[model samples]
Target: MTIIITGGAGFIGSNFIFYMMKKYPDYRIICLDKLTYAGNLSTLAPVMGKPNFRFVKMDICDREAVYGLFEEKNPDVVVNFAAESHVDRSILNPEIFLETNIIGTSVLMDACRKYGIGRYHQVSTDEVYGDLPL
Candidate 1:
């Protein structure tokens, strides 16, 4: 099986990539990361040379690039973890958050629909629940 993991260079996403790569040695894992402030490519160094693993640097909001990748890979599963996730930064500039988190997600889903994917999983942080007064 082939899986496309968006934001695979970020914290949570990187961990998932490691786990999946180890557990399923035969599965093809394509990592699509924009290399944002939150994303670190070094985190994925361990699996960089693995035959079943490949990395692609690009933003989820880029529809043409995303569509091209989907056509080339034709991944069976798409795990979306891409987002502008710094709470402090988001409070300062909410537009970027809206663009990456909302619009980017829509772009990914549209590509999935257009290119055909068996499954699409969205991974969101607990921050989505909003902060409660302490």
Candidate 2:
């Protein structure tokens, strides 16, 4: 199965990819990242040449490009992790956060739906749930 993971070069996303690739060698994993400050190819350098791994540098908010990728890749599953995950940054500039988290997510979902993706997953921040008392 082909799985598309957005923001796959980020912290959590990168770890998740590592886990998936280690656990299931049979599955194909495609990474879509905008290469923002948080997204780094270096994080995924270890897995770059694997036969089942592919990377695409593109913004999730770009509808045309996203749809084109879906058409070209025909991914069977999608995982949305493309978002401005830093709460401190969000507090300073909420617009970028909204565009990445809300608008970007919507566009990706639309593309997934159009391509008939069999499964969809979202990796969201716990900050959205508010801080918990320790």
lDDT of 1 at 22: 84
Top TM-score: which candidate number? 1
Q: Could you tell me how far off, in angstroms, the CA of residue 70 lies in candidate 1 after the best superposition?
A: 0.0
What's the TM for model 1? 0.92
The local distance difference test score of each candidate is 0.90, 0.89
For 5-118, candidate 1 gives per-residue lDDT tens digits of: 999999899999999998998999999999989899999999999999999999888989999999999999999998887789988998888777888888989998998786
lDDT of 2 by residue, 1-134 (tens): 88999999999899999999999999999999999999999999999999999999999999999999899989999998887877789899989887888888889889878889878887766543345789
Which stretches in model 2 have alpha-carbon errors above 4 Å?
126-134
Q: Where is model 1 more than 4 Å wrong at Cα?
A: 126-134
Which whole-number lDDT from 0 to 100 does residue 106 have in model 2? Answer: 88
C-alpha lDDT of candidate 2 relative to the true structure: 0.89
What total of clashing residue pairs does each candidate reach? 0, 0
